[model samples]
Target: MSPRKKIVQAAFEKKKLNGVVARVGLVLDISGSMRNLYLNGTVQEVVERILAVASKFDDNQTLDVWIYDNEFSRLPSVKENGIENYVAKQILNNETLHKFGRNNEPLVMEDVIRKYTKEEPSTQPAFIVFINDGGVVKPTKKVIVESSTLPIFWQFVGIGNSDFELLRKLDEMEGRFVDNANFFHLDDISAISDENLYDHLLHEFPEWLQAVKSKGLVL
Candidate 1:
């Protein structure tokens, strides 16, 4: 096994998620402010790391990908074999989708909900990793609250120095059928070790799985 995949598998074992089966998706912030991260290869690294998690968690070993700014594009799904230069090939070089613009969380978020709940419904749960540098809006709360009962778990990661107030307060958000999201902040994702990063990424997921299973959110 690849080293990163081994690290992710170890993380799953540590979290007692050894037998869990789920779909994995990645949402990247392509807003104007994120230009540096993308250009510096940070976004590509993020894709590779998340793809490792998908290698272990997803039955098909594929990672569904989406990039969003004011608008969103559902790019082709990523498999471990094709992870080389994924961000550059799929997003930067691909002229078909919107590039860096302003942030609009609700639009892309709603589409993610539609994909998992309507287009390709599944008995297995979906674990979505949402990466944003900042500028999350209030409208996003409505989408998260409304999608609370669905078989999707949102793991929001704030990368950069932004306040991320709304993301930071996801746990305290009200009126959800269940707590469907978790948030963590990192000044620089690449600075973290693989083991530590996987630990943080999977931290709240097991609890969310237990809660959702008891509520029949996942079959």
Candidate 2:
């Protein structure tokens, strides 16, 4: 097994998520402010790391990918087999895809909801890893609240030192059937070790899974 897969598996075992199954999705912020991160290969590294989690969590070992600014593009799903140079080939080289623009979290978020809840519809839960540098809008709260009852958990990660007030307050947000989201800030994601990163990523997921299952959100 690849080193990342081993780390992810070890994290799963530590979290007691050995037998859990879920569809994995990655939402990358392609807003104008995020241009540097993309150009510097930070975004590519993010894809590779998340793909490691997907390889273990999803039955098909595939991760559905989406990049968003003001608009969003649902790029092809990525699998373990062709993970190398994925961001460069599937994203940077693709002329048809959307790149840096403005931040519009709700637009892409709704489409993610549509995919797991409507288009593909699965008995397994959907685990969405949302990455952003900042500039979160208020409408994002509405989307998270509305989607709370569904079998989806949003793990929002803020990269860099920017104003993430709204995302930071997700844990306190109310009026949801269940708490369906988590937020963590990392000034520099690449600096973190894989083991620590995996631990942070999977931190709140197991509790969310237990809550959702008890409420019959997932069978």
TM-score for every candidate vs. truth? 0.98, 0.98
CA lDDT of each prediction against the hidden true structure: 0.92, 0.92
Stretches off by above 4 angstroms in model 1 are none
**Window of ten residues with lowest summed lDDT in model 2:** 79-88
Cα RMSD of predicted structure 1: 0.8
Worst 10 residues of 1 by lDDT: 1-10
What residue runs in model 2 are displaced by over 4 Å at the alpha carbon?
A: none
Task: Give me the overall lDDT of model 1.
Answer: 0.92
Query: Candidate 1 on 18-131: residue-level lDDT in tens?
Result: 989999999999999999999999999999999889989998999999999999999999997798988888888988889788899999888888999899999899999999
Counting only residues 3 or more apart in sequence or on different chains, how many pairs clash (N, Cα, C under 3 Å) in candidate 1? 0
